[model samples]
Target chain A: MSAKSVQMVLYPDTHLDQAAETIHRLRQHGIDDRDISVISGVPYSDKILGRPMSWTRIGLIGLAGAVVGFAIATSLNFGTPYLYPIRVGGQPFFPIPTSIVVTFELTMLGLLISTFLGVFIETITPSYGPKGYSPKVSDGHIGVLFSCPTEKMDEVKKGLEDLKPEWVKNPEAKL
Target chain B: MAAETKTLSATHSASQEGEDLRQEHLMHDPKPREEMNGMVMEAMQTTSKKYWIALAIFGLGVLILLFGFWGNQIITGMGVTGKRRPVFWALYITTFVFWIGISHAGTFVSAILRVFKAEFRRPFTRAAELMTTFGLAAGALFPLIHLGRVWTFYWMIPYPNARWLWPNFRSPLVWDFLAITTYLLSSTIYLYLPLIPDLAMARDRSTGWRHSIYKLLALNWRGTEAEWHRLRKAINIFAFAIIPVMFSVHTIVSWDFAVSQTVGWHSTIFGPYFIIGAILSGVSAVVMILFIIQSTMKNMKYFIRLEVFDSLGKLVLIFSMAWAYFFFNEYLLHWYGGYQAVRDLLTFHAQGPTAWVWYTMLICNVAIPWLTLWNRKIRRTPLAMFIITTLVNVGMFAERYTIIPLTLGEQRFPFDWGAYSPRLTDISIVIGTFCLFIFLYLLASRLIPLIPVWEVQEGQMAHSTRKLGKGKVTSVAELE
Candidate 1:
């Protein structure tokens, strides 16, 4: 991509409705949906962001973590035997009922930790150093970032500027 | 400059003729950010000779009761505790249930209200989460301490050793360990995730070792669009998932007793009973902490208003009723069953050595919140609510004590039945745990932004004034 065409930043009002309208305007243009991004101080859903559905595999990752946790718990509950053997309360060598607790605990631990890591993996967070950012965005401003062809840069900026963004700027710095 | 200052004071006195309505609120009397930060830092840093003296007292208490008393108990072999043959589980188990119940308020405040988007919960979520972490920390210790040998705690885990000793999975105690451990981990993670943004804020505003500490904890969070998006998605998922986890934890804790074949402990209704009791106690603790924070901390009164206490009071009333219903259900079922051991435990609870504790528990847990919280005036009054909430906790603690050791006094075999008296060490450790909770909370209050500023701002954005025919009304929108 050419330098001018690679990125654009638009500052919309904090109002939700206005932000939505801005998204509608961009989609009306030929900008590919994936190229658009919305950022705000608070968390907003995709529907609010005016984006297509995100295919986040957070749930699946959590499920995988749970499986791993369950296996470990089960092995610990049952496998310690060949190495050494101990029996208490005269119940059984391997107890399914008690093992369930350990399994559940491990499953939850796995799910929570994996979900946390999943957020990092999905978003690539903790990004320090110079990047395309504005601290005012955190003070109740909606920022919309998009990409388009260099020839269409003027057209895209004008099109977005017509929507009355607070400020429209070219790529200032790369994140 | 002198002329302008004189004019400002002249205007200030003219405007401030009335009761100086500003002092009524901590939040309304807002200070500059730098000033507020300095106040918080001062509170953290300004430990006095008196504070150290008190800490030393507590430390000595810990030494005497925990080490000395526990040593005596071990050398004497569980005799220091009133745990006789039939009532093997005594004061320690009672304290376990009590502390676990106290832990529930944090999850209820942070996760459930967060899912529903309660604005009032924004400021105190971290405070509540601290309660959860500290409560669980204290609660977990009881089980270990009750194990007596204290060293062989590993036997609780499933393993094959020369002894071939696998812990009984059917036992509720084993279930409790897993459930508590899971909840502790989940709650800790949940607590930390939201604190990242606040830690970054702290980092931005700090210097020296504090800056480094916050920086490391902030994890280089720069509040990027992608980062916010991911954090939002993760939080929403967690909010929904954690509610069930919190519910499961208390239910499992309840089952520890309910699953047993013993009379008072064997009822099917005990599961819901324990859960309601937990929420009742938990909500009261939240109210008490809110009161303290609002009164003591700078910029807190504005965020925690009478509106919050009003909502919490209502919850306390509702949960109080639910607890009463469960209590009646369990009592009636056992009464109707006419089982000898069940009736004996019930009678023993009412008329035995701990009879005063039994009656007081009923009055405090059921009667006070039920009667007084119903009135809006009493509910909104901070002092009144605080007293009622403290009583609720006292009542909840008594209920656990009666259930654990007191009921155990009435056993099937009279020869094995005995009362439980906590050794001196038990008392010390319990105090230490309380001190530990307060110490951690005091440290956290200064270090972390107890009020989630971003969440509060989000809530404020969702709220606005709308005009109707005659007056203005507050309204909220579904921003998400």
Candidate 2:
């Protein structure tokens, strides 16, 4: 028979020091960092929690959007005027001063819109499927979610109970 | 024994002072996260009979005054409005600029303050951001209302057409369209980004239809480290990005007049002058709204403390001085140039039939803020700040009134000059926009978490009181 791993949760009150200690102890208990996730009502920096920093591509996406916006503005201002040329008061069809305004506005528009959409893309948002979650997290509690081999569940629970969490149980059953 | 008694007395006095400081500042006063969340949720959920009555009245005002008058204007044509000949842009343009200026309060208070790490901004940033989105909604309507034929407003969009006619990118009007559109979208997104975690909190606690709404709006936020990390990064990007965009928006709006050939309208100083004026009115509007929120909402007194009013009053006072400088610079240059038409316009502004507006602008924007805000007691007093901010906005409106119709009343040739006043439709539409803004705000106050609970909690976490040389002092940690 194959050994299966079970997801467990530990609820701690809103104390960064305590949460940090619990996470440190968990790491010492043979749990890899990738196998554990922390949820809380307030954001804690990775340094505060002694965890690895997470990276995001939102800035890159915003820059890409800016380039696209610049392209559109250039085409509209520089290229379209040639198609239906309407010369006014001996001014050039593509006036640099006026073109700058349109370019700046459009470029910003693209950057903002893409940055907003980037949040959704990066987070896989509007995801409605059931996942390992705890309502206590929103109530300003820190929830530590981790997986352990079914055979080792007893040992992990005993180890976590020493930390004095509110509860330690399988998240699937409680959530 | 005598020395021990003295030391105990001094220690007791220091602790008392520390306690008093906590009472005065929201950051120093820390509440449990659950309690703070409950207070915010209660504030959102609790509504009174007066609230509903006010909402209904504002809603009716919007329907009758805004939409009804606007619809009548559209059907009856532009003749019904006061726009005629040289004074073609009148009250509609003035109010349009006023509301756009009002929208700046949100970005200035929320984004700029966030970037600078102003601790007092924690509770009210959401309120100011809401003002940005709704103020833009109210302000963006005027250009369409001024369009005469509102249905064909899409012609301003840059798209391929059957006749190969594209909007003139060279025209300031087109820039106004682009700038306002970008600002509206950008501010709305900025408002929504900080709101997601709060929405998730609401979702977890709510039931029925409210739960469904928050669930969708929350975007299934789980408060995971990765999600929070990305959200913070995105919010930081927006914080820095939106400031220049905010400045650009009003600068473009100013160009609408500055680029014109009108003697009083053309000036290199208009851009910075308009920007300073906008910030003055914007910050004052924020103070006025904060007073309203603190007074009306439940449990808001705990969050919108007097310290916030004191800090914002300082900003208003500084901006007023800056505005005075620009006002003088613009006036002195025009007076020094000695151009006959420009001099006549300046004289007409002071001695015209509507000279009351010019005086009101001076007294309210300059005299009142200068005299009153310097007193810390008055600045800290909510009611006094409210009255002063309200007058400042009144003064700002008068300033715009002077610039638009009053200035347009003057010309190089006396024969071609004429005075302009808003007719009934124009007045109704202006009042309706105010009603529209209030109505949207009333609804939004109930629907969303007006006070950002997480941000307040985060701030409280970073703040602590420690003893420094036998005196207690509040210290803040750079948590981010």
Name the candidate that leads on DockQ. 2
DockQ of candidate 2, scored on C-alphas against the true complex (2 decimals): 0.73
Q: List the DockQ of the predictions in order.
A: 0.27, 0.73
TM-score of chain B of each: 0.88, 0.99
Worst 10 residues of 1 chain B by lDDT: B18-27
- For candidate 2, write residues B1-480 as lDDT tens digits: 999999999888877897899899888888877788889899999999999999999999999999999999999998998888778889999999999999998999999999999989999999999998999999999999998999989989998689897888888999999999999999999999999999988988888999999989998788888889889988998999999999999999999999998888899989889989999999999999899999999999999999999999999999999999999999999999999999988888898778889999999999999999999999999999999999999999999999988888787888889989789999999999999999999999999999888898889888988878866778899877
The residue-level lDDT of candidate 2 at B284 comes to: 95
Error of 1 at A2 (Å): 4.3
Q: What local lDDT score does residue B232 receive in model 1, on the 0 to 100 scale?
A: 69
Which tens-of-lDDT digit does each residue in B2-114 have in candidate 1? Answer: 99999898677645632243343222233333344444445544555765675666566556655666677678777666566677877777778888888998999898998
Top model by TM-score, which number?
2
